[model samples]
Target: MNQPLTLEELKQVMAEADLLKTEADVEAALDKLAQEITARISESLPVVYGIMNGGLVMAGRLLTKLNFPLEQGYMHATRYRGETTGSTDLQWQAPPSVPMAGRTVLILDDIFDEGNTLAEVVKACHAQGAKEVLTAVLVNKVHDRKNTELKIDFIGMDVEDRYVFGCGMDYRGFWRNAAGIYAVKGL
Candidate 1:
């Protein structure tokens, strides 16, 4: 675990961060994502699971925009326990909260970085007997280092390859509540 940053240091980090997407921009993207998702699965009565910690904000915001009736749940699986970098293996702190067997499953995550965590979660959904599994992310970090073949079905936005935080993403487990998206300076 990393030493928690002092309040002053955390403020300095935010002061030095570059704002990539404003809060309005994120809200607009969520509106669009909700529309797209509804067009595809509004009638499927899908089981939506948010990958916790990171997906909490995204899921909460997106769910309000989606008018259709669907079951909501959460799972906690992470490669980065509270750091910037990720480990090779996934850690499942909590499994799916609802059964997806023979049902359509939709997984929501905050970011699709290297894709390993999202891919593994999708695989797990399938293994749990989901008739179909789809993945969505609030942000897709554009880079060539993606290690998995999984393609996100719905994406809110594409961000440059940088250490980004905000809109449910965190910088060393902080700033996940920042209304806008930001890239850490020099990261």
Candidate 2:
């Protein structure tokens, strides 16, 4: 196992990290996502679930741009608790509290890396009798290691296959409130 970084060390790492997406870029992406979501399901009363912690930022930002009426909730499921890498098993601390039966659901998350967590969440939504399920992510990692055939309905940006943090993604449980997305150097 790797030694955990001290708070100072984490700050140093973040200071030297490369900025992948600027705040302006993130705003533009949210605007686009909002537009696409509106065009696709604005008339439908969809339950929007933010995959908690990481998805909070994206969901909140996107919610401001959406003009239609919608219900919002959160789901807390994670493969990485506070570690740099994910584990094989996903832990569901909390599921969506809203009623999803026979309703359209929109699940929003931070990044689509391996497609594991999102795939399972989508399945759970369907199991709950969601008539239609749509997914959106702030960043889509350009990788070849996807474990499912699921396609994200909306995307903010396509990032290189690197460990990223900020904009609600954490590095060792920090930096989620950073202005933009950043990739750790030499990770």
Instruction: Report backbone clashes per prediction.
Output: 0, 0
Writing each residue's lDDT as its tens digit, candidate 1 over 1-187 gives 5677999999999999999999999999999899999999999999999999999999999999999999999999978777667887778899899999999999999999888888888888888899999988999999998866797999999999999999999998799999999999999
What are the lDDT figures for the candidates, one per model? 0.92, 0.90
Q: Candidate 2 on 1-187: residue-level lDDT in tens?
A: 6677898999898889999999999999999999999999999998999998899988988998989999999999877776767785667889788989999999999998888878888888898899999999999989899876788999989999888999889887789998799999986
Clashing pairs in 2: none
Q: Where is the poorest 10-residue window by lDDT in model 1?
A: 80-89
Worst 10 residues of 2 by lDDT: 81-90
lDDT of 2 at 11: 84
Q: Any runs in candidate 1 off by more than 4 Å, and if so which?
A: 80-89
